[model samples]
Target: MVNQAKAHIAIPMGDPAGIGPEITVKSLAKAEIYDVCKPVVVGHTEVMKKALAVTHTNLEINEISEPEEGKYEHGTIDMINLDNLNIDHLEWGVVQAQCGRAAFQYIKKSVELALEGKVAAIATTPINKESLKAGEVPYIGHTEMLEDLTNSRDPLTMFEVRNLRIFFLTRHVSLKDAISQMTKERVFEYIGRCEEALKRLGVENPLIAVAGLNPHSGENGLFGREEVDEIKPGIEMAVEKGYRAVGPVPADSVFYQALQGKYDAVLSLYHDQGHIAAKMTDFERTISITNGLPFLRTSVDHGTAFDIAGKNIASSVSMEECIKLAAKYAPNFRS
Candidate 1:
């Protein structure tokens, strides 16, 4: 029976060629995971079995057609069996069209389950973009696929590690593009959204600190004018409108300050700015929570480590944290 108090989180095994299945198995091996939520793998049954052998894990795979059918207990992994992989042709760490297609199918099924409210949230594994291309899937990454699937416009990405939370202003773009996109209106817009996003995570009256574009927050226009010109003005607008926003705080210290509990979250100006901070603090525990979706979604910050695909040495700490974070926020975020 599905536990009424526990959220149902769907985990889409990443690229069949990568460590997604392996990590999924390793993460679920812990009994503590069952204590928090009911997690069901929304991927291939055969791939999971292969992962079992790779991890040398002893657990029963309970195939279920729906989330409610899951046992949601320790020593058992309940799965929604897609039965899609051709186990004979499966090779670890290689980009294959079949693996890409299977990966996409898993994500699609996961989205369906979440949209139907059968699952409270989704904790996704990594997917290979090269394999996705080879499979003729048009989407470049998880965010793009999720935005389209959920009919969500510009999904918000938040990185949470320990007590620190961060939101990106721009990602997957060159440094030049990121700078140009940081207009006052854009910054102001994101601050408001960031505040709302934090509120969804159950943060009360969040105080958001906007990271500076230049050193020392431009040092009163000495280092760079982005802070004086674009960033500060944007923050002022948000403050005027009753949002508890501040800075163009010096990038070097803003994150540290947030970690120290001075602010509820930091709005990072670019991808590397926030990623570096989160990963550097504790790489394996930095989980990416995708806000602004109909249902909550959390993912591991790392990618499909193709080189370590079948290697049992791959760590499952990030995967476990991803599922736990999804469970943690599911109650507050879900409809």
Candidate 2:
């Protein structure tokens, strides 16, 4: 009720062989979702039909050629059907190359709509990596594929769990390789980027906390030298440049402190460190927001649960959260 305008969010039906379709159906079933955004699924009609049958959701699918035709009303699911998926071959709880290809196609369509300004933002579902590999998709995951499609360079990944926000220095790289890439320059660069990203999300004069790479931040060089050699200087450099930055805060306590409102956000040095902290705090609510893209993009943090695809047990909390975030931040995307 605070804001009456509803942003249009594009939902891509990820690998039909997975839980994407089901979750999308379940999420769209919520009347609360229609309150803030007009969501149109960029997927196949047959796939969504099958999902509606499985989930027993009462909403009717209204396929539109574009977002402009959407009714954007409760009890009606407006979709941009690609008609790419053949429902006959889809087997839930399994990976299929066709499903992977279909999923990629859905994302491609979503990106196209985003680029054309047909939608305000995109709230994505889980796509199977094994399926992507089997389908011979060039990019490994959504982030990389999005980066390539938008021609955006190194899009920053930010996680929002409640009030706490986290940014990774590196993701999907080997632990050793990630460590090697951590230098004063890279850390400093990430700090500045994080500041810019926060501002885009409507935060002004944000405070950033950079996590240490070692135990107790190297205990003044006893535990590891990376903190002393690289991290400390990075914070100092950001501060010198007039950025509101702090820490080499210990990985063990930094996330907790940030969650407690001591800091606006934390800059995790590697993948697992931040992943563990975020997932531990709240797994289902930890949504990933890709900042620096041409348009706003949000995703469910979890992957496609192939093990429990069609039983209708997958929690739609994350999917709902993803769309909510897209609606919340869509106004900020320069794209």
Candidate 3:
């Protein structure tokens, strides 16, 4: 049975050449998933049927043109078939331009549904970057694509695992460029944004701790001056503006402190800083949430596993977590 009060979560099938289809089928096969939300996969029905056969899961594929037509039952999987992939020519574990284009179309459709209020939220699978480039897609990854599609400016990314939340100050840039881009002004702007993002996630008063750029937070200018020169001043400015911001805490210990509940969230100085902490804490459950968008979007932190595509061995824990998180936070998301 399905919960009529539950929100509808639109799932975008990732790269067809990878384990996305496998994971999607596996995750939806679990009856517990229907308890929280009505999930509608936005992708090719043929691809999902292939996934069902490979995984040996017995679930009926109920194709529908819109989310409203979904059965939302435990024994059935509802899908909005885009019919973009040719399963005969599709090779698992290989990058194909056609697969890339198909993946983009699925995401585009899910985003459109979310924007139109047709779905409560979107829980996305992994898309291969190489395949996307081969297809000549304009965006690099999901975040960039969502930003462009929604016309959102500087959407904030927050990773949650086991009650610990981490916000990246910088992502997808070289360590050198990341360091160079860390300015007081940027920090100040991000702190306010981070605070707002937390509030949107239902945190009434978020105490955000900013991680340091150097060891021991520059050891008070011993290891480096980035803390004294920029980070600390930025925190001070944010504090003066009535934001509950703290740190230039030592990068080594701040994540642990946040995990221990000392802070509501940690503002990581760069990509790996936050990614390493969250993934190390719990790799499978480290779900990514994109804030500052018109609708809530959650995704599996893992990538499309090309080597194990169609192998029935890929774990769907991350995908399940992504959908659950989207459902958990959808009610609070602002339009």
Each prediction's TM-score versus the true structure: 0.98, 0.97, 0.98
Query: For residues 73-103, what per-residue lDDT tens digits would candidate 1 score against the true structure?
Result: 8999999988887889999999999999999
Model 2 stretches with alpha carbons more than 4 Å out: 1-4
When sorted by lDDT, best at the front, the candidate numbers are: 1, 3, 2
TM-score for predicted model 2 compared with the true structure: 0.97
Residue pairs in collision within model 1: none
Who is ahead in lDDT, 1 or 3? Answer: 1
Q: Candidate 3 deviates by what RMSD? A: 1.8
Between prediction 1 and prediction 2, the one with superior lDDT is 1
Candidate 3: which stretches are off by over 4 Å? Answer: 1-4
Candidate of highest lDDT: 1
User: Each model's number of backbone clashes?
Assistant: 0, 0, 0
What lDDT would each prediction earn against the true structure? 0.92, 0.91, 0.92
- For residue 249, give model 3's deviation from the true position in Å: 0.8
Task: State the local distance difference test value for candidate 1.
Answer: 0.92
Tell me how far the alpha carbon of residue 185 in candidate 2 is from the true structure, in angstroms, after superposition: 0.4
